[model samples]
Target chain A: MDLATSGGEPERFGPTIGTLGEDALVSGVIDRYPSAPWLTVGPGDDAAVLDLTGSLAGPLIACTDTIVEGQDFLRHWSTARDIGIKVAAQNFADVAAMGGRPHTLLVSLTTPADVPAGWANSLADGLAAECSRAGAVVAGGDVSSGAEIAVTGTALGTLAVPRAVLRSGARPGDLIAVTPGSGRSAAGWALLRAGLRDVEDPVLAALVREHRAPVPPYPAGVEAALAGASAMIDTSDGLVRDALRVARASGAVLDLDPDALRPSADLLRAASVLGSAAGSEPEPDPRDWVLTGGEDHALLACFPPSAVVPAAFGVIGRVRSGEPGVWLGGRPFTGEGGWRHWS
Target chain B: MDLATSGGEPERFGPTIGTLGEDALVSGVIDRYPSAPWLTVGPGDDAAVLDLTGSLAGPLIACTDTIVEGQDFLRHWSTARDIGIKVAAQNFADVAAMGGRPHTLLVSLTTPADVPAGWANSLADGLAAECSRAGAVVAGGDVSSGAEIAVTGTALGTLAVPRAVLRSGARPGDLIAVTPGSGRSAAGWALLRAGLRDVEDPVLAALVREHRAPVPPYPAGVEAALAGASAMIDTSDGLVRDALRVARASGAVLDLDPDALRPSADLLRAASVLGSAAGSEPEPDPRDWVLTGGEDHALLACFPPSAVVPAAFGVIGRVRSGEPGVWLGGRPFTGEGGWRHWS
Candidate 1:
C-alpha cells in the first residue's frame, strides 16, 4: 500500500495520497492550472470570488453532475486522466446545450486513502487540458477521503445573447437536425464489452478510443443558436431519448427518416469485424446503436424549414403536429436503450 | 433487500432506489421544495438558469463541498436528515464568510442502489428546510448510484457591497473577533467518541445535537462586511488552523488571549460528564477542543481597533507585526490537532 518513490514513473509506482496529507495533495492538483483574470479569489480560500460585471449580457446558466466508481466507470477500463477529461466534457456539454459559453468549473473529488498520488496529478492535468480546450478555467475545488473515487463537477457559463435556446421552443414545422458522429461512443463501449482489447482493426481501435474519451461538439451549439435554432439539447442519453425529450417538452411529434440514419463507414467496418469475431451470437446492428447509443454529446437542434442548416449539422428528422413521441419510418419506435444510473 | 411498503412508514421500510429508477427518484427528491421567482429554469432541464439581472450590486461568489460516508459521518451516528442539514449549513457558511448573501444551491447526491427510497426523500426535506432557514432555494441537483452516500453542494451568492471581505486584507494593529459559540461542536464530537451517548444530562445532549447540526450565524457575515471588516474566514478547520490561514495570507501575526476563550457552560458540562465516564484515564482538556476542533463554521473576522466590534461578535485576539503564524498567550502555539482528510 506504500506506493511512494522519488522518480516520475507513475506507471510502476508513486506515493499514496494519505502519506502526503490534504494540503500537499491539493497543491499538486492546483499547480497544474494557470491563474486567469476572471478569478478574483482563486482556489486557496473559503469561496471563489468571480468578477462577471460586464462579461455577461443575460442570466447565468449553471449545471452539476456526478460520476461514481462501479456505477459510471471501472478503473481497469479507463485511466484517471481519461476520467477527468470525460467529466469535463460532460459538464461543458451542458453549457453548450444552453447556447452559452462556459466560464468556470468547481470540482469535488473523493478518493480512497491508498490511491496513488500520481493518479490525482494525472487527473488534474486532464482536467486542465480539457478546460483549456473548452475555453474555461478550474476556479476552485474540494478534495476528501472516501470509500471509492467519485467526482462531482459544477459548470458556470454566461449567456451573451438575449435568450437561451430552451428545449420547450420547438415548433410543429421545425426540422430536426443532429451533429455528425453519433453512436461512436456506444459502439466503442460495445467493442470493449465484446473482449476486443488492443484491437488490430483500425476501426475497432478508434471505437475504443471514442468510448474512453469523447470529444463533444462544443462550438456547434452556439453556432446552431445563432442560426436560429428553436430548441436545442445534447445527446447525452441517446439520439432517441434526447429527441423524445424535446418532443415531449415541445408537445410535438418527431419523425425520423430511416434512410437518413445509415451507418457511417467506421461503424460498418467495426460491425463487420465484431460479427466475424462472434462465432454464434447475432451481429450487432450499427443502426440500432446510432438510434439508441448514449454519451455522444452531439448537439441536437430544431431549425426552421426555411433556415439554412449549419454545415456541421445534418437533417435527420422533422417535427410534426401529433402526440408527443418519436416515430421512425412513419411508425412508433419502441426501444428502451439509454443510460440509467441505478439500473 | 426489497424493503418496499406503502403508507408513510419510511422509518420501518421502503423500496430500494434501484426499483424506482432515476427519473422517479429525482422527482421524489425535487417535489419537496416550492418554486421560487428567481429560478427561471428549474431542475428538469440540462441546466438551471437564474435571472440575476438587477438582483445585486457586485460580482458573484461561489463555493462547493462534498461530504462522504465513513469519512465525514457515520450512518449510526447521524440520521439522513442530519446529513442533509449539515451539508447545507457547511456550504452556506462558506458564502457568509465572504460577506455574501447565498441565493441558490445546487446539490448532487450519489448513493448505493440498495439504499431505501425514503432516505433520499427525507434528505431532500432536510435540505429544503435548512435552505429556507438560510434564505436560499434549491434550484437544481443531480442524483446517481454509487457505492456509498456522498453529497456535493454548490452555493452561489452575491456581494451586496462594492467589495468582499478577504483573508489577505488583515493588517497590523487590527482586532480579531469571532461569532459567539465556537467549541460546542468539537465538544459534542468528543462526547460522542467517548461513548457518552443518550446521556441524562441535558447540556451533554445539546452538545451532541450541535455536533450533528451546526447553526452558523449567516446574517452576521453581511453585518460585519457592512461594518467594514477587513479580513474574514469560517472556522471549518479549527480556530487555531483557520487563524493561521489568515495570518499566513495577510503576512502578519495573530495572538490569542487565553482568558478571552472562557469555556461556555455547555462545554464545561460536557467535559465534566466525559471525565466521569473516562473511568481510569486522564480527563481530556476542553481548551484543546476549543482551539483545534473543526466543523464549527463560526465566522472569524478582523476589524480596525477603532471600529466598534459588532454586538454579535466577541473579540478574542489581535493582529501584530511578526512571523506569520498563530500565537496563544504571547507564545507561538504548536499543536497538530486539526482535521486532515487523508491522514
Candidate 2:
C-alpha cells in the first residue's frame, strides 16, 4: 500500500480532480509516460500510433481485463500505485499466456471526481513502471468520471514463434508445468482478510504485498513457447480452476500430484504466522491456497512428452485422456473458491 | 431509448448476471460475435489472435474510450443498445480522425451484478451492428461486476497511406471542413432533456434517436486522407472545443464563417418542435448546439489550398496564422459549455 516508494516523491495533496478538470488531469497522466520510439505517435493525437512492422510475426495477440473498486480491491487496503501495478501485471500476463511478448497497453481509467490529482499521477507511475518492466509502453488511454475507480487495460503482444500456444492445444500425455511459485497471493489475502495485517512476521507481510502487486514471470512464457508448449494460460483464477479451463478446452483431464500442491517452506511459514494470529481455530491449509488461490498471474503451461520444460517452470502435473476436468491425487477435487467477478 | 428495434427480436428477460456467473456471461457475450476467419484464435483463448498481415499497410492506430453510467449516458435516457452503439461510434471515430480504417475493437464491459442477462446480449448486438457498419469485427472483450455500466472500447485501425494524418499537420492556408451535418446530436440531447420525446413530428423523434445512436461517416476519413487532407479530428468534444484542440496542436488559428455555422433546416425544424413541446420558455439556440455540442462523432478535417475536399465533407472554416485558438466571425468566441468528465 506504500505508493511513495514506487515513483518520484509523492506530492503534497493537490487540487481535487474537479478543480483541475479532465484535460489537465489527462495531461499530467500523459506526462508520466515519456516518449518511446515504438509509439510513433503518443498521447496528443486522437489515437496513438504503434510501429509493429519489424516487431511482429504471424499474428497479433490482444487481451483485456477490468479491475473494479469494491470487487477487485478496496481503496482502504490498496494504494493507487498497487492498483496500477496489479492491473498491468494481470493484462500483460494474458499476452504471455498466449506465447507472446506484450508491446503496448491501452488503459481506460474511470474514477470519481473527488479523487485527488496526486492519486492519478501515482497510478500512472505504477503503470509506467510495470510496463517498463514488461518491455512495453503505454500507447494511449481514456479517462472518464465514475462513482468508483475502475481500470480496464488492453494489452497487445507479438509472438516470437510462428504459432501461438493456446489453451486447447494440450494433448494427452503432456507435462503440465507452472512458474516457480504460486498461492502466495491467496495466503496474503487470507491474512489481510483476517485482520493480521500488522503481524510481526515479515514473511506474512510479504505475502500481503504479493496480493497487492503480483510479479508475473514475463520471460518464462516465451521460453516455454520456444520449448514447444502445447498449451498455456495465466493463473488469474487459481491453479485448479484455470487448469480446468485448459482441461475442458483440450478435452483432456489434468491430474495434479498432491505432493506437488503442498505449500513451499516460505508459504507454510506465512500460513503459520496467520494461524497463530487467529488464536484457537485450526491452521488454514496452505495447500488450499496453492490449489485455488487466484490473481497470482503465474504462467501455467503444458509441454509434449518429448519437449524439455523450461528451467524456470516446475512440472506439477500431466495431461491424460479422461472426462474433461481437473483431478488431485487421482480423485476429482472440487473445493471451489476462485476469483469470480459476478459471484 | 428503444433497444429492441436495432437488431433481432429481443429475447425474453433472462436470469440476472449473478445467477449465471462470469464464464457463462462471457460465453453469452462471445456468442454474439461469431467466429471469423481473420480471428485465428477467438474468444475462448487467453488472448484473441488477429491476422493483420495483409490487412495493414503502415503503422497501426490504437485508441481507447470509456463511457461510464452517469457521466456518459443515463440508463433511462439511453437503452443498453444505444450505449453499445455510442461506444462503438465514438471509438471508431477516433480511428477515422487519424485517417485510418478501423479494423477491430476490444470491448471491456462492467455492469452491476443484478443487470438482466438479456441486456448484455442486446448490448453486444448493438456493438456488432456498428462494427459491421464500420467494416470491423469485435475481436474479443472482458466482462466484470461493478456498481454501474461502463464500456471501455479499444479500436485498432490500419493506415492505407504511409503516415497518419495528425492534428498538428494543418497549415495556415488550410481549409477547415466537416462531415455534412453537425449539432444534430446536441439538438437531440436538448430535445430529450426538455422532455420532448413524444413530440408529434417524426423529424423531432429522429433527432432523439440521433442523440441515442450517432452515425459517423466512416469511409470519408480514408477518402480525405487519400485526397491529401492536412489534418483531421473527430468532433466528439463539440466543434469549438475540438477545433481549439487542432488549433493548439497545429499552432494556427481556425476562423469560422458565420453563414456556414447556420443549422440545417432539419435541425431547426426539430428544434422548433422541441421548443413548442416545452411551452412558452425561450427556444434553445440551434447555433449554440452547432458550436458547443459534443458526441456527434463527425469527422472534421483541414485540407490544403489545392486539395479537393471530399464530397461528403462541407467547408466550414479556414486556418489562418494567428494565436492558437478558435475564432467565429473573425473574433475569438468563448462560450463555456463542453463535455468535461471530471466536472
Candidate 3:
C-alpha cells in the first residue's frame, strides 16, 4: 500500500476504544487532519462550518460511499490505515468524476468495542493523508459501536465549470479515453484471493499493494472538464461495465480498440502464474484484466473529436450512434461485468 | 411514534434485498424522496449536485451521525421506517444547533443480506418524511452489505444569519432556555425497557412512541440564531449533560431553576410504573429523567439578557460568571452523564 511516511510509525500499543471513552478517542484523533482555511468551526462542536461563498457559483457536488469489513476488505489483507485510505479514495473519485474540486469530507466509522483505540488514530492518519492529497479536509464525523468495522465517507465538492460532466452528455463522434492506471487492483485481488500475498515477483507484490489502495488520477478529471469533455465517469466498476453505463445513458455505442489498450506485459505474466496455480485451466488473458477489472478508479470520459484531450489520458475508443452498448474490436463485447453488492 | 400516514403503509411483503441486488434495491427506493429545487443532479449519478449559490452567502454547516441496531434501537421496538426518521432527526438537529437551516442530507446504509428488499423502501419513506419536516432533501446516498444494519447521515446546511451560533459564544448574563420537548424520549426509553409496550396508560404509551421517534423543534434553532442568540446546542444527551457542554465551552456557570424545568408529569407516572415492575422499594425520581435522560433532541440555547428570545422557548435557567459547570437549584448538579459510544 502507498502509506504515509512523514508522521513516523503510529504508536499502536494503547488502550482499546472500549476503555477510552468516545470523547477522548475523538479528541485524540481529530487533530490528525489539517484544517482548511474555509473551516470556521470544526470538531469539538455540534457541527463544522465552512465558508464557500464566492468560491463556488453553481451546483455543489455531494456523494457518500461506505466500506464494510469482510465484504469490502479483510483484516488479513489490510490494516486499519489501509482501509481508511481506500474508503477516502473511492469517495473522492466520485466528486472528481463530476468535474468538481473536492472541498470537505465527513467520515463516520463504526466498529466493535474490541477494536484498539489506536486503530482510530491510524485510520484518521490515513484519511487525513488521502484528503490532503485530494485538496480536501476531514470536517466532521461520527463514531458508534457495531458488529464489525464500517467506514462511511460523504464527500462534498464545488464545480470548476458551469455544468457538471454527466454520463448522458456523450454524443456520436466523441473520442472515448481514460486516464492512466487501470486494472491493477483486480489483478491484486486475484492474487490475494489465491493466497499469494507474499508473491516472490516484485512486480506482482506491487500489484498486491495496489489492490489494497488504488490511486485515481484526480486532476485529469477537472482538466478534461475544462477542455470541453462531454461525458465522464470513474472506472470503479470494470471498463466494459462502466463504458456500458455511458453508452446506455447517452444512447450511443462505445466502440473500443484493442490495439490502443496497450495491455501491460507484467499483468500477462501474473495471469500465467494465476492460471498455473489453479491447475489444468486455460491461461487467463491480461487483456481481460485491462477490459473487465474493477476498482482502478481511472477516469473514463468522452470528448468531441476536435476537443484537446489531456496529455495524461490515453485514447481508447470512439462513440458511435448504434445500439446502446460497449463494443470491443468491432464485435459485441459480452462478458462478466464488474462488482455489485450482494450478487 | 409520529409515523407518516400520508403515504400508504410500505409494502413489506416483497423480495429480500439479497435476491433483488443493490442496483435494483437503490432504484426502487430512490424515488421515495421528494426532489428539492436546489438539487440540480440527484441520485443515479456519480454524485449529487446542489445549487446553493446565491441563497446561502455565508458559512455552510455540516455534521454526521450514525445509528446502529441493538445499540441505538431494537427491531422489536422500531421498524425500518422509525430507524430512518430517528437517524435523520438526530443529524439535522446538529445543523439546527449551529443556527443553520438544513438543506441536504447524504445518507449511507450498511445492511446484512437477509434484510428485506422492501425494508430499504420503507427506510427511504421514513427518511423522506423527516427530511420534508426539516425542509431538507435526501440528496444522495450509498448502500452496502455488512453484518448488521447501520445508517449514517451527513447533514449540510446554510446559516440563517451572517454568523453561526457556536457553543463558546454564550455570555455570563445570558438566559438559558429550551424549546418544547425534553425528557419525553427518556421516559419512553424507560417504559420500553420495563416491558411496558402495551401499557394501558395513554400518556406512558405516548412516551414509548416518543422514544422510538423524536420530533425536534428544528425551526426554533434558526429563529434563535436570527434573534441574536449567543450560543446553542441540541439536547441529544440529557439536559444536564448538554448544559454542562455549553457551560464548559463558554467557561461560564449555568444555574438552572428546577421549578422552571416543569418536569413532565407523564414521566413521573412512568417512573412509578418502572419502579413497581423492577420490585424496587423506592420509586425512581422522574426529575432524574428530566435531568439525565437523553435523545429528546430539544434545542438548548443561551440568549443575551436584552435579546428577544423566541416565544416557543421556555426560560429554564440563567448563566453566571463562576466555575465552568452546570448547577441545579443553586447547587452543583453532579449526576450521571449522558450517552457515550463505548461506555
Candidate 4:
C-alpha cells in the first residue's frame, strides 16, 4: 500500500513532473494501450481509426467528461490512475445508460509542473484498461501543460440496433425499475473525508473501492435493453436526482415506494462511519443518500409492468402522468441533493 | 469592431455573468452548437449519435487535443473565446490529416474561478462558429473548475472510402509536393511578439490569424486522397519536421527543390518580416523558416512525378531512397528545431 520507494527520498521518476515532455507521456500511454483489429491505424498516425465492419447505420452516441484535481478528484485520496479510470467509467456509463456499447475514447490532459510522472503514465494505463473493459479502445489523445492537473475523456459508442431507448421515451404504465441501489460511494466519500482508515469491514472496503474505481453495470444495461425496457438511465447522480433527469427528459411523473428499497438499501459499516462524520450537523437521512448520492453508476430503467426484471435489479417506482417530478409514497420527494463538480 | 456601447464603460449584457450558472454555460454551449445532419441524436440525450449511413467498413478516425494557458496559448494576445476556437481548430486539423471528413467534435473544458461568467459562453460561441467552419458539430462535453484555463477537444471523422492514408505509405518513386508552405504561424508568432499592429498587412494579419486559428486544409486532403497521393501529412510541427515523420514512417527519404517554393519565396512581406526577426541570430536561411518553423497547417503530399500537381499547389520536393531524412536542393535539410510541448 505504500508507494514510497525503499530509498530514503521519494522515488524521483523522469522529468520530476509533466516535464519529461507531453509526447513522452502520450507515446508511453499509447504504448501501453496497444491496438487491435478495430483499430485500422493507431497512434503516430494523423488520427486513430476504427473499422466499422459490423454496423453502418449504427447510432453513434458520444459522451465526454473531465476530471480536475482538487475538484473532481483529490490527489491525496485518488491517484491519477484512478482519475483516468473514473473519467472513462463515468462517461461510458452515460453510453451504457442509453443501451449503447462504447467503441472508442479520446482523452486530453493538462498538468502542472509539480504533478508526478507516474500520474500521467498510470492514468493512461487506467484509461486503456477501462476502455478494454468496456469493449472499447483508448483511441487517441493529447497532452499539454497547465497550472493544475486535468484529465478529459470523450467516449464514442454505437447502438448496434436502431433503438436508442432515450431519456424521452418513458411513459405512464411503465414500471420504474433499477439495476441496483445506491449510497455506497457516498458512504465511502464520507469515510474518506473523515480521515478514517483500517475500517476492517470487507463490504465497506468494497464500497470504498467502488467509489474510487466504479465498475459500471455495462452489460446489464444492454441486458435491460434486450429485456424490453422502455427507457433507461444510469444513476450517476443518485436515484432521485438521476431519476429526475429521466422524468424531465421523458416528460413523465415518476412515483417511487420508499419501503420498496429495503433490500437494495446500502447498510454497510462505512455508512455508520460516514454518518458519525456528519459532526452533530443533524445528518441527512441515509435513504436520501441512496435516493440522491451519485457516482455508483447503476442503471435505472422503465419497463412495462409484465416485463422481466433481472435478478440484480429491482422495481421501486412507476411512471405516471402528472407534473414532471418524482414522488415518494404518492408525496413529493422533498429533498434535492446530488453530486456537482467544483462545489 | 467595438464590443463596447457608446458609453465609456463596457455595455452590460442580459443574464449578467453572475446570473448564469455552470449548467447554464453547458446548456448554452450545447444550444449554440446544433447537431449536424449526420448526428442522429445530439447532446442532451444519454449520448450523441452520428447516423452513419455510409459503408459498413468505413473508418472512424478520432483525435483529441488540449490547449492550456501560458503553454499552448497566451491570453495576452488571444481571448478565452479565441482560445476556444484554437482548441477546436487544432483537433480538427488531426482529422484533416487523416484524410477523413470531419463530422463531429466533443469538447471538455476546465477554467479558473476568477474568470468572468461570460468567459465560457464566449468560448462556446467561438467553438460553435469554428465547428461550423469545419463542417462538424459539438456532440457533447464536460466542465469542471480548476486553477488555470484548459480546453480539450476530441474530434471524430469518417473516411469516405474504407481505407485510410497513413504516414507509412510513401515510396522512393513518389514526387514530393506541398500544397503550400506552413511557417506562417511561426512568422506571426514573431510578429505578435514584436507587437506588430499593421492590420492592413494582409499577409501579416493572415499569418496572425493563421497562428491563432490555423485553418486546416480539410478539402485538399480529400482531394489528395482521391488524387492518388502516395503519402500525406499536415505540416504541423514545421514542413521538414513533419516530413521527417513521414520519412521515418514510410522508410523513404524526401528531397525538396528550392525553386519549387516560388509561391512562398515570392512573399514580399513575409521575407521582410523574417529578415527583421533573424537580427544577428545568424541570418539563417529562409528555407529553415519554411522548413522548420511550424503552425502553418499546410498540406504536404507525395505522388508520382507524372501525377498532376493541382494549380492550388506545386511540386516542392521529391522522394528518394537515401538515409531516412529530408533534402533541400540535393543536400540534407539540417534544420533541427521543432515546437515541443513541455521540454
Candidate maximizing DockQ: 2
Write the residue-wise lDDT of candidate 1 on A22-92 in tens digits: 88888888888767778888787889888875665367889999888776666666677777888888888
Q: Tell me the tens digit of each residue's lDDT in model 2 across B1-343.
A: 3444433335336798888888988888898885556778888778888888776646889999999988788777777788888999999999988889998889999998888788888788889989988988898889889998899999998986778899998899899999966788998888878877655577777777888888999899999999999999999989999999899989999998879989988788866766676363587788888988998888989999999998989999999999899999889987877677865
List residue ranges in candidate 4 displaced over 4 A: A4-12, A15-19, A55-57, A197-199, A262-268, A275-285, B1-19, B54-57, B79-81, B261-288
Q: lDDT per residue, candidate 4, B1-343, as tens digits?
A: 1342111212223453334556666676677676666777777766777776644226778888888888777756665566777877777777877777877888877776556666676777778878888887888777777777788888888785547778878899788877664667776676666666344577677777667767777777777777777788878778887888899889988888878754364344655665665442433355556767776768788876667765546678789998898888889877678777655
Error of 2 at A256 (Å): 0.6
Native-referenced Cα lDDT, model 3: 0.86
- Candidate 3, A16-38: lDDT as tens digits: 88899787888888888799888
Ranking of candidates on DockQ, top first: 2, 3, 1, 4
Candidate 3 Cα errors over 4 Å, as ranges: A1-8, A54-57, A198-202, A273-284, B1-11, B198-201, B275-283
Pitting candidate 2 against candidate 3, the one with the higher TM-score is 2
DockQ, in order, for the candidates?
0.77, 0.85, 0.83, 0.63
Order of quality (lDDT): 2, 3, 1, 4
Residue clash pairs of candidate 2: none
- Compared with the true structure, what per-residue lDDT tens digits does model 2 show for residues A1-343? 3443333435327887778998888898999996667789988689998888666645888888999999898866667788888999999999999889998888989988888888888788889989999999999999899998899999998876788999999899999999966899998888878876655677777888889888999899899999999999999999999999999999999999888777988788877776776363677889888998999999999999999989989999889999999999888878887788877
Chain A structural similarity (TM-score) per candidate? 0.93, 0.95, 0.93, 0.90
